[model samples]
Target: MSSDRTASHLARNLAALRHARTLTQQELARAAAVPRSTIANLESGEGNPSLAVLVKVAGALSVPIDELLAAPRALVRHWPADAIAPRHKGRGVQVRDLVPEPVPDEMMELMDFEPGAVMGGTPHLPGTREFFTCLDGRVILMVAGDRYELAPGEVLAFPGNLPHSYQNADALQRARGVSVVVLAKAGV
Candidate 1:
């Protein structure tokens, strides 16, 4: 979406969420540590809130930041499964959960990498980006010949076109993570 559309959408959602919570403009302003005029301007669709301001608004609304910026659920497209393809013989790289269908230009997959599983170097398709978050055990993700270890709650996003792979650090525990691969629908 264009930045203008995004800003307007966020402004509307913020205004709706704020009103739904029965918060007055003054109340929201105090809670978010921003001026009342800022909230008013955002609600009036005359201003753009920075990410930091959005976070503050999220805190004020007691919701995740993404909740305030998501498109309407009905309008979100299904994520195609074909975009995610993994090569390996290890136990930790099993596909667990998919977001049902391809979500327009993006795909999300939850992969469970079994301990002792490792994938050797192989470059990803050009124009692709991989985003992973360590959900369980430590995982070693290699990108462009460099190794990086990730712990639970940690996230890594990089170009998929580079030679990349992931290794399970231990066999005693399961190494699980979520890999969100984003591919261009046409330009790619």
Candidate 2:
């Protein structure tokens, strides 16, 4: 999927889901705790949505976060970096989705970590697990109060129900890595 198509899918899916529940734009916005304008922009495919916004909307709709972002798909989807890979920026980090369509129970993302970048994540539902593999540089992952240092080619796996955080360990170099999250129960 290209970026344009991704936006179109989001617009279509959002509107369809909202209508399916007989929700007006304002109603859905209230449910999602977002401004009506945000919902309008998202449904019009005219604005960038942060991960937090997507999460809130999905929760309000009683759907998975991926349900809002994934494109309709057949088997054997291919995500070319230049096309469907929209880099989602955080305070000091960058992330790209690696899957064009949502899998039954999984999420994959590529992360670029600038020096001093830190990301904190709340606990996922029970039975969820997350894995991280360092592709370049180093990072310190803190999960459930346990800190683990990961270098290139190293990997770490842990239950996602634990509060977690990560930071680039190298003060002068950026780090890159892949993160895979598995939900024990699909679409939960």
Candidate 3:
């Protein structure tokens, strides 16, 4: 690719990856051991970064150098169910990431709670919000010291920064739900 095109790809990918990781320019610069101004300039597509700089940035972002210069991906992608691994929580809880990659400021997860199972919520940055919809069976959500009984088709919204947890209400049935978390924007 032409130098200009490569620079453009680098700028876009760098910004996207940084956002997905919830890192500010300053934080990324610190992690990459680069000057903060360099990060700013690169993201603005105004710098011809050295190979050393590229390597440092890629290492900090935990991505390959080629990913930094690769062309934008297609808008639509498919992730097979079996291809995604389920994260088992305490007891009989299973959580699966619905997206193949981390989305900027957002996350979607599929949750399954076997009978008598309980799972603690993972808190996010301040201002983050969580939405949970019980798709089948029943779930009892505990948030901010309050208990909520959710039946199938019921939805609950709460601040994700606060303490929360979910439990299967029934002792003999499995409960399934979807959780969507929207993270707070950096410096907001």
Candidate 4:
């Protein structure tokens, strides 16, 4: 491909990757040990960066150099239900992986709580956050000595490092919820 094409790809990929990680240009520059203007210029497709700069940026993003130069591809991905196996946490609790593939610093799970079922949440690293949303029925969430009752479509956000647990509020109905945990970046 031509240099302009390669630069365009790099600009798009770099911006997308940075946004996906929720990093500012200044933050990425600090991580890559480059000037913030360098990142800004690169993302704008106005910089013809040196090989050393590219290598540093790639290393900071934890991606290969080829990815920065490759043509953009569709981001949509489909995961069939049967493709993922559910984990039985206990007699009445089931947890299914929402994201089958490993994602850095993030995890998502679909949880089902049978009548009167309870499941304790595992604490994560400091600065991690957990978001739980009730999709069906009702769920009782206990965190840090506080109790929250969540109905369908209700959401609760809390520190992932806190002691927390979930329980089905109904005695004869099953409760379903989705939990998304975002972990802190290492060394940050």
Candidate 5:
């Protein structure tokens, strides 16, 4: 299945489970340790959650992670874990692998982004270079006092050591995109 479909499916599952229990966005946010807007976005089908999020939400709702994140028609391309949920680094942003896990040691996986999302404000990790491309909408990228607004089909590449963040320029709709981290060759 496509990333969009998978994201939509996960969002739906989260919404259903979150609402069925009479939990407000704020309540769920507290229980899950996510932002209230994140919950709103998930329920509205405009956000995707990382594996950590899936786990926290499941724990708060008192259910198994599989119950809220299983994809009926989507099977893992490799290990079963790949089909479970993608893990993320950073906060206030949803991220998951776009490909199967145990990504060849030579390569890394993609981090998915949603509308109005920003990766946690932290220093980027070393030993890698990162790139991004907008899949469906515009994205505003800011780093080291520089800012760039990228439209669909545009791509940006940069060293991953600078502090960085992103935002969806759209006032509405999901600003879908992917972050590619190509790890530097060892002993470079």
Candidate 6:
């Protein structure tokens, strides 16, 4: 998402989460160690909060930064393949969100990989988890320091907060998969 869009999402999520927790603007400001006006402005989606402010807010809310910042999606929506943009595109690798909006609890993406394609070193907020299901060819889903091999129709789930990677297992073919990222939430 563009920075403007992200800030808008942050504004919406911040207000919703704070209200859900029964926190007033002043209360959240105190908890986040920011000015009440800062909270107010953020809720209004009128300013670009610094990274420190964002971290403080996320910490005070007990949510991972990603969940707090992710663009909110409607509960029900649809996106045609051509209308959807790839989250990442590079030599031998492509990824697209399966849904229109990023959900607070989870998000899913579709990935395509050519032999030798590798997407690596990405990690979500602590306590997050991911499920990867191979839909075609073969792939390897690596979490932390372990590698899990997957064939078509195989599914693997693991902690996503740790460093993780995905790659085509075969050096001469292609692979495809769907990844479901589950964001940790309170009481879940």
Q: Which candidate do you rate higher for lDDT, 4 or 6?
A: 4
lDDT of 3 by residue, 1-188 (tens): 79899889999999998997889999999889999999999999998999999999998887889999899996466778888999997689999997777565689999999999999998888999999999999999999999999999999999999999999999999999999999997678
Which candidate gets the maximum TM-score versus the true structure?
Answer: 4
Q: Give the per-residue lDDT of model 2 (tens digit) for 31-137.
A: 78999999999999996899899998998887787777788764255656688665645557788887665544578888899988898865778999999999999
List per-candidate RMSD values in Å: 12.3, 12.5, 4.7, 3.1, 18.4, 9.7
Of candidate 6, the 10-residue stretch with the lowest lDDT total is 72-81
Q: What's the ranking of the predictions by TM-score, best on top?
A: 4, 3, 2, 6, 1, 5
TM-score of 6: 0.56
* Residue-by-residue lDDT tens digits, candidate 5, 5-121: 776777777777666666778988987788888778777767767888778877777778876655755432455754657666544355666654333222334444555566643
Q: Which stretches of candidate 3 lie over 4 Å from their true place?
A: 4-65, 71-78, 185-188
Q: Which candidate number maximizes lDDT?
A: 4
TM-score of every candidate relative to the true structure:
0.49, 0.56, 0.65, 0.77, 0.48, 0.56
TM-score of 5: 0.48
Write candidate 6's Cα lDDT for 1-188 as tens digits: 78888879988999888887788999889878999999998888887888898899988887888877887765345667789888665568899888665444677889999898998836777788889999999998788789899999999988888888888999999899998988875544
lDDT assessment of candidate 3:
0.92
Task: Report how far off residue 33 is in candidate 4 (Å).
Answer: 4.1
lDDT of 1: 0.76
Q: How well is each residue in 18-40 modelled by candidate 4, as lDDT tens digits? A: 99888999999998999999999
lDDT of 5 at 81: 55
Candidate 5 runs further than 4 Å off: 1-82, 87-92, 104-114, 121-127, 185-187
